[model samples]
Target: MTTKVRETQICLVVFIGLPGSGKTTLCRLLLEFLRTSCKSLSDILHHTISICYDELIPADKFRYQDESSQWKQARRGIVNYVKSLVFTLKDIEVLNMVNSLEVAVREELLKVVQNEKKTRVYIIVDDNMYYRSMRYEYYQLAKLYSFSFCQIFVQCSVSDALNRNSSREQSTAVPEEIITRMAERLEPPDRQNNPWEIFSLTVPSEKWTVAEIKKISLFLNNAAEHPVVMPERNNEMCQESRRICSTNVIHRVDIMLRKLVGDRMRERSQTSVQRDDLQELSKAFTDLRHHILEGIRTGTIIIPEDTYEAINLDQSNCGHRLQDFLNGLLTIS
Candidate 1:
């Protein structure tokens, strides 16, 4: 009698946690475990690929390394807008990059599965899946490919995360304040409410081992037998997601705007601008403060739609105003 081989298909495992929460550490350990465990599984030969969210960020004019110049130049204004709002815009860019990479990675994994015919292909996504929308993106991908998707949330206290961050090299360690805010805002996976949360594991205090890896492998093998049904987004959830996105965007814009104002104020102080003129500029900012606050509360950044031309025009006007103010103060010098 001949024995038939059981095969595991393409699957995704996403890590969710704050920076310095040991997410990357857990991923490295899990990958090592999976590679070693595959040796014992008689018919299972697993090929795994790891993708990091930080590596997806673009470095060139397109803000992404893999983009075409023509397409990038055409959408340069959008790129500038994204760059200007450095905080929340990174999240948006990373999400879109992840979505695009998922398709390509899935195709490659499927090809391997097709060729091997009896082997498992796993894609490990290492990132801070801090929001539900981020996790939902991967969940949708799983349903589209009919592949098992799992999440591992690395849980650590804020103090522990801070201490871990401090011990890291300067280049890798993010600011302590950013980590603190991320811990406060992190939205953990809820398996009961969302089907994409299959094989969810919470590694508390960063304790993980080969046993956890085997458990996840077993979970995915079991999950393959059952089809995933994504839950509908209720009105409440929709509202909450929107609220979170809007709040983050507004906060980032506010930070950028305040920094711009501070820079201009320092420039004015260094110039020969008179006290009266400085007071007038300060009053203008005071007036604009109300408008800025109003815009934030209304969940929008109001800018003229003339694209790059508008940006240049605004800069020219500001430069002219500052020059005139300084020239008017030349008598005092």
Candidate 2:
């Protein structure tokens, strides 16, 4: 008799640190570490992990409202939220990252959680732990969801982090005031809640070093298949991501098809009313097509527009006709 193994519940990991604090670096490392660990322990060869960044959420729409338990996902209309998912959500109009803290957490984080049920996924939250000292909120989340998580803080001297960010070909992202604010409120993790074993050089029991920086870079490369944003480039990345899968990008060449054929067909018909009769219109069109086909087939050219205008269209539509339509729909893609 063969025993079937049940699927393991997914683990959610959230990293908190200020800008340049190395949350993004740790996230990359964790992805590789998680993949290796899953394979070794479960003997699952093709294990999958999905990492979602908090700032990448379309925050403008899901504005962070005042603190209230009612700010749960159900606060919005069902049909409206679904419509947002198809376009308005992904192709966000506004690009601001500020939101009501609690509400932002609920709506955006929940969206990530719900969308990640496709496989044995690892949900990584890449936010600096600038707010709450203990990750009790995360722990409560884990308890509610029947899975656990680890908090990794990439500890560094604020000046050192700030300096490292400055020297990179890239740039550091946080405003000076926010960095100062985070530092003032920063709390080093203690023993009882030693839940998150931090890593710097090797989980940072002290401060960061040149060797730690190298290790973190190596780790992030293994974590993700895509170049997800690291906060500073969040705006640029979000727009590019939206464009890559945009319907507008894919359909631009056919734009005139809508205008010339069906779009302006009504206007085109008025001009064609003087063709005397359907037979006359059809005969003129036949000759035009014949001429156009000869140009394409024989390469003599110069006759396509003569054919097009003979069909009662104009120079504006030199190549876009029935033939062009066929080439678009069937041949050239």
Candidate 3:
């Protein structure tokens, strides 16, 4: 007798955006809308993980304050808000992500492709996914997993983000320098390079109406069924995945930085300079490196292990030491 097969579908949606840009809020709104109209989305909407009690300040737009009391209140708000979230990738996915980003992103994604039996693994990524390097890593993961990818670009004015942050009493937020850099790196999503569609939502004077929320919910329902397949690129030389073992976010970030500010940064050391002067050059590159990384997802540098060793840039030990050396460089020129 012939045996029948059992196939189950899994829908995954990765919501990426700059910090404090309203990704979580939109996700919440989307969930609220979905629960009422689309059963599929409603089912998943119950699993949101609040990052903070008040709100998540976009990394690119975060600010700092000196008042201790005010800062504590904002922190409390974020914690409370986080408590309200229904689902969090924390225990299952995020922990794995922190432990071994390379394995979590690359290996897990590859497993999905290699699996001959599993039907569908739909994942929805909900975070401030503004970095190109980070997004590229996920894109590479999708390619490895053979899973389709799409994008939902929520267009919000700076005023809106600032206003929302103010209401939350958040005295700290992603820096303006980072936000400026992101704008420089920002590339509008479309059907070409990523074939991932995008939607720009303009908040009505204040709150989103129930009907509008419902519309977003319906959209997610339809999107889950059919994901966008990335388009193939020609003259593809930069195809090898980044080698860093950190989370896709950090790894891709480092890769982008290295590419942007390669070794011999001061190759033309002005009027006169000795090889020993490379330290100054390295310092310059590091500062430029961080600022550049903040703007673009992927940068132009590509330093291998050999180069890291030669320049004494140890990935394992280059934590605070490296930051201290390059702190001044991260600033925008």
The model with the greatest TM-score is: 1
The lDDT per prediction is 0.56, 0.40, 0.42
Candidate number that wins on lDDT, 1 or 3? 1
Better of 1 and 2 by TM-score: 1
Candidate 2 local accuracy as lDDT? 0.40
lDDT of 3 by residue, 132-239 (tens): 333344443444334444455666556665555555534455556555555455544433322223322233333667776776544545654554354453534533
Model 2, TM vs. native: 0.38
**Per-residue lDDT tens digits of candidate 2, residues 120-195?**
3344555554544224344434433444355556676788667655665532344555566677776555433232
In candidate 1, clashing pairs total 2
Against the true structure, candidate 1 reaches a TM-score of 0.50
**In model 2, what are the clashing residue pairs, if there are any?**
16-128, 16-129, 17-128, 17-129, 28-220, 64-100, 198-203, 199-203, 200-203, 200-204
Question: How many steric clashes between backbone atoms does each model show?
Answer: 2, 10, 41
TM per candidate comes to: 0.50, 0.38, 0.44
Candidate with better TM-score, 2 vs 3: 3
What lDDT does candidate 3 reach at residue 49?
19
